[model samples]
Target chain A: MKVVCIGAGNVATHLSQALYKAGFVITQIVSRTEENAKALALSVDADWTTNPDNIEDADIYIYSVSDSALGEMIHRNPRKNGLHVHTAGSMSLSLFEGYKERGGVLYPLQTFSKGKAVNFKDIPLFIEASNADDLNVLRELASGISNKVYEASSAQRQQLHLAAVFACNFTNHLFAIAESILHEADIPFEVLRPLIQETIDKTATLSPREGQTGPAVRKDFNVMNKHLDKLTDHPEWQEIYRLLSQDIINNHRG
Target chain B: MKVVCIGAGNVATHLSQALYKAGFVITQIVSRTEENAKALALSVDADWTTNPDNIEDADIYIYSVSDSALGEMIHRNPRKNGLHVHTAGSMSLSLFEGYKERGGVLYPLQTFSKGKAVNFKDIPLFIEASNADDLNVLRELASGISNKVYEASSAQRQQLHLAAVFACNFTNHLFAIAESILHEADIPFEVLRPLIQETIDKTATLSPREGQTGPAVRKDFNVMNKHLDKLTDHPEWQEIYRLLSQDIINNHRG
Candidate 1:
């Protein structure tokens, strides 16, 4: 199938490459800068264009752009020879309300980083659309590259995105906070990697609730007091420590 | 080497089976209950004892008992022959003070569940001792089963344990909260599994800071506010969402 991928950022790079690898022809790649679009287009053997209006017709055109530019970009490109889709999790399919009768979503529920090769075969793609035919088109496109695919409405997808904040985004923040604390103490962050992997591994077998442990879950007040005391010099770390510990205890006990 | 396991709970079950698999002799399995002790002992083709006083001498005595019971358990039975080691993370090795001079720590940093099968090779064992000989003995023992072993001081191990609360325990709580929210909304919690796995996979290749994504990291106030509005009926969840979202933005912006 011929494909046109809009945007040259992380998602675009990963998605276009995966689609190309899975035997889909990337007919065109669009970006604000000619150089940006040219780079990804070259990698996928697709024609590159700086102007979105210059995008050629294809079986599917994916607007894998920022949330703010989604509506504007879709509005500017009025001619839709085929189905048009956006990859943004927060933006609804309604953004293409007047743009195309065949509009849908192809949201890959994974964080993408440029220059890294990701195996999309197992990565879940949450799809949505305004109609059944468009849904089928998007599903066929998504399922071609990945085995894990689901049809999520805007509301469900947004909730999933919110959960991703807690699970992925905020969790990474916690790691950064940990890295900062360890940095201040001259501790090597490498030591925490195995623990981090094990923590992630536990979720596969048991619910996090069942696998919960530590001073917080055990309610060891003495050890908790000592950790708090040690953090007296670092108020930010102290606040996180206290509140998270309390939250774990309260939630686990209840 | 002859090893006497001093508990038949989660740690003992896993450790004993692993030691047995590694061609080590389990001299006896000691526990308060006959069935538990016999069950573990039978796995390693060793004797079982319900009384600490009846604990047999071996090359090493691994105390995998509860943290609350460590003090009394040690007082009840002095290290008769070989080095003594306790597997508690937060507890100090000095808990065996006044006992024989061979006391040390053999704390495995992973959460162990009784019925679950854990690959000991993947578990990182944190070993510490008051003296070099004890450390080597523990090292030799730990190296038999796990490739990852580190000599961490009690203070450092305690700090690592505290950090584990954030990375492992606290992170799991966040997962639980996410699961609960999805459950409350009648959404299948399974939808988030692939995203969860990808989040962990990304952290291995990139710093958590660079890997952070979602509404908070993107600073998408519209989506954040929408999720908050949905959480209005659950004030507790709302507070958690607000606090964590703010933390994500604060950490990323800083």
Candidate 2:
């Protein structure tokens, strides 16, 4: 089936490439900039377009644009007969109203970094469609690309996305904080690699609650105060240490 | 070398087993209970003891007990000639004062769980010996069991431990929070596994700051507030969501 991908950012780049690799005909690549569109279009052996008027006949048009731009992107779409699917976690299927009768979502519940290689087969695909026929089409396409696919309503997907913000995005920020602390102390960040690996590995067998250790889980205030005092120079980090440690304490023991 | 483990908790269990496996003769396993001590003692083919008066002479006495109980455990140790070391991250070498003349610290900076096998060679071993001779002994022993061994000052190791709380302990709590969020929504926790793995994997090559992504890094407060609103049923979680995302925004663009 012919697929046209709109937007050429990280999600768009990864999703378009994966779809093309899975034998979907990437008929065109669309982006606001000619350069961005052409870069992705050339990679997928498809035509490039900057004008919304240049959009062509395709089985699906993936609006992989940002959440802020979804409305404008949908407003400019010229295709009236194709499946208008989005790759947003928080957007409702109703966004495609008056744009297309066959509206759906094919949100890949994973972070995508452009120019980085990612195997889409195991990345859980959360999909939603406005109609039965559109849902079937999405299920087939998603199944071909991924082993794990679930049809979630917009509400559930929004919650999942919020959870990802905690699980993925905030976790990465905490790592960044740890990196800064290690860098300031002239300690090699690599020293913590094994511990970090084990931290995640334990979650496979034990629940995160069961895997918790160190001062916060044990509610050792001495260690918590020491950690806070060490971060006194960075007051923001100190607050974070206090707040998160307190949360853990209250959640576990309270 | 002859050794005695003074506790049978997670760290004590793993460290004692690893030392025994590395050909150290575990002379005794000492705990408050004969049953608990004997369990570990049998695993290493060592004598078990609840009474500190029964402690035999060993080259090293490892105090792997809890932080709160370290003082009491130290007071109970009858040995006066051995090299006394601790396997605690946040503790100082001064804790060994008056307990042993040859004292030090042999902190294995990793989370240990009972019944789980972990490779000692990969786990970072942080050592802080009280003297030159004990330092050399710790260096030799730590190097024998672990490839990643570092002779760190108490201050440096404390900072490392603090950073670890952020990276390992707090990150696991975030996962627990995520699990709860997903649970309430009836979403499967496995959906976030690939994302979690990639978040850590990227940190291996990219600095965690460079690896940061999502609305927080983008300074997209619209979505951040949306997430907070979705978490209305969970006030504590909402606060965490707000605080972490705000910290990310402040750190990146500040």
Candidate 3:
């Protein structure tokens, strides 16, 4: 299989490497910047081009650009032959509306950062296409790198993206908030490392509901009230505590 | 050093077993119920007793009881000489006020669950004491179990605990929300396992501010508004999404 990765960011960087490692020929690498495109292309032994016109026709075109810029990318590329796929969670695969019939989603369900090594085998791939043949092709492509792949629809992927906000993005925000609090108190955040790892590890064996602990789950009004009182000055933290505690209470009740 | 562990709950169970494994002589395991005491005592090859009076004087008396019942525990087990400590984050070492000479905090900064094998060496221990000598003794005891020991004050520990509620407890709630949303969509939550792991793995390499990726962080108001609109009925999820996005935005602005 041949692929033309249409961005030089984290997702593109990692996915291109994984595909290339899996023996898929990356025919070309395109990015807004010549340096980034050249760097990744050199690494993967593919042709590098900053101009969209230089993008070659291939079996697959992965538009792994920023979500906001995806529509603009589609407009610029204007490819009508091969399959055009976007590696975005929230963006609809239909973004490539005027393109070829092979347009679909090749979304790798993991948070990727530039230069960080990602084990594609452990990451899940959500594959969706317009037809059965395209779907099977995408599935084969996804299955080459990952053990877990699902034929999720655009609506389902959108809902999954909304949940991803809560699961991955928002959860990290919570960690940042906690880090900020500890920073202000002149406390090292390292003390909470074990607790964080254990909390994540518990989900491996038991459901988060069953493993839930703390004042909210225990319904210790005294501790809850104490924590609320402390967060009075920080309304954001207070709002978070209230909303999450209410969720915990509602979860337990149900 | 000789140690007497009070309460046979998760912390007590794991702590006693670890101490025994580390070649420390655990003289006794005390609990409100004989069965609970015996269960942990047998693991450590120590004697068990339900009565507080049966707690023989050791080099250290570690109370691993729930926060609410701490005061009564201290009152019941009056120690004349050895360093007495409690493993609670919010609670102060002053809870052992009557025994001013040898009172401290030996907080194992981790969430412990019964039936889970916890490697004590990996868990950080936050220690605090009323006096210098007692601090050293408590520090020594802590060092035996974990290389990561910090002499944190009562105020520092309280802040750390509050931070933990956001980092660990509330983060788990986010996972619960994700699980619920996936369940509603008839999508297997296991598909998100890799993404979840990557979310955590990203933190190890970069500051969460540096690692932040999503529609919210990018201020892609279109996707954000779409998600909010989708979550109109699920007010709880909407509130979380709003609050966390705002926090992320505020943090990233610098």
For lDDT, the strongest prediction is: 2
lDDT per residue (tens digit) for residues A1-254 in model 1:
68888899888899998999888999999899888898999999999988866878788889888888888889877567788889987788788776787888888888777655678898889899988888888888889999998888887777777777777776777777676656655666666776777777777778878878777888888778877886788676687777778888888675
* lDDT digits (tens) for residues A123-227 of candidate 2: 999999977888999999999889989989999999899889889998999888888888887997778889888988898888888888889878788888888
Model 1 residue A179 lDDT?
A: 68
DockQ, per-model, please?
0.53, 0.82, 0.67
Model 3 C-alpha lDDT per residue in residues B1-254, reported as the tens digit of each score: 78899989887888888888889999999999888988888889888889887679888888888888878888888566788888887888778776535789977777766676777898888889977888888777778888888888988888888888998889888988888888878996677777777877777877666778887788888889989998888988888888888878877884
Candidate 1, residue B27: lDDT? 89
Interface RMSD of each: 2.0, 1.0, 1.4
Clashing pairs in 2: none
Q: For each candidate, what is the lDDT?
A: 0.80, 0.87, 0.84
Off by over 4 Å in 3: B53-55
lDDT of 2 by residue, B80-190 (tens): 987888888888889878766888898888988776688888988989986788899999888878888888989888889998999999999999999988988899777
The sequence of per-residue lDDT tens digits that candidate 1 reaches over residues B38-65 is 8888889999889888777788888888
